[model samples]
Target: GSSGSSGQALASDSEEADEVPEWLREGEFVTVGAHKTGVVRYVGPADFQEGTWVGVELDLPSGKNDGSIGGKQYFRCNPGYGLLVRPSRVRRATSGPSSG
Candidate 1:
């Protein structure tokens, strides 16, 4: 998780959500960057922590330990393949088949 101390949402994200729903729910395709693709696997507060997070299964080896942070499992996946990012870090895809 790149976001530290994230028990709050960015003001910009609420502002952005007004447009087109921001469809950042489970099973949707997202990308932190342009080329990398990831799937939204889990969306909610994790165990022993606060704030909302999104568990994304990244296509590339771009993530940290597999869905477990602080020795707790929020989602399950391969190492370096699971990304627990703030919902703001991911953006819905523009023009591709999304699964949500």
Candidate 2:
């Protein structure tokens, strides 16, 4: 008889976990602008309901200049879709000190 482990082997879950990027930590900020655009915020386990990684809530700047609308909005990102902001036609916010 052949070794039972030879044909029926198991892979370690730790190896797989290592390959995945750790979720973003809370309070961490990402810059969504011309140069250093898009920041990561609220990193946590995938939402059971939405099945997404909780990300930053965007407040779009006024007018269509870069690629973002001039208003406030929310976004949810995953490994495949990246940043899925509503009104994808709009540009990202400008890089500067926020007015508020």
lDDT accuracy of residue 22 in candidate 1: 52
By TM-score, the best candidate is 1
Estimate, for each residue in 1-80, the C-alpha lDDT of model 2 and write its tens digit.
76555564435653223121332333334443343334444343332322234344334432122321223223333323
Clashes of 2: 11
Candidate 1: stretches off by over 4 Å: 1-22, 33-35, 47-49, 95-100
Worst 10 residues of 2 by lDDT: 61-70
Q: What is the lDDT of residue 3 in candidate 1?
A: 57
Compared with the true structure, all predictions reach lDDT values of: 0.76, 0.35
lDDT of candidate model 1 versus the reference: 0.76
What is the alpha-carbon RMSD of candidate 1 to the true structure? Answer: 9.4
Clash pairs, candidate 1, are none
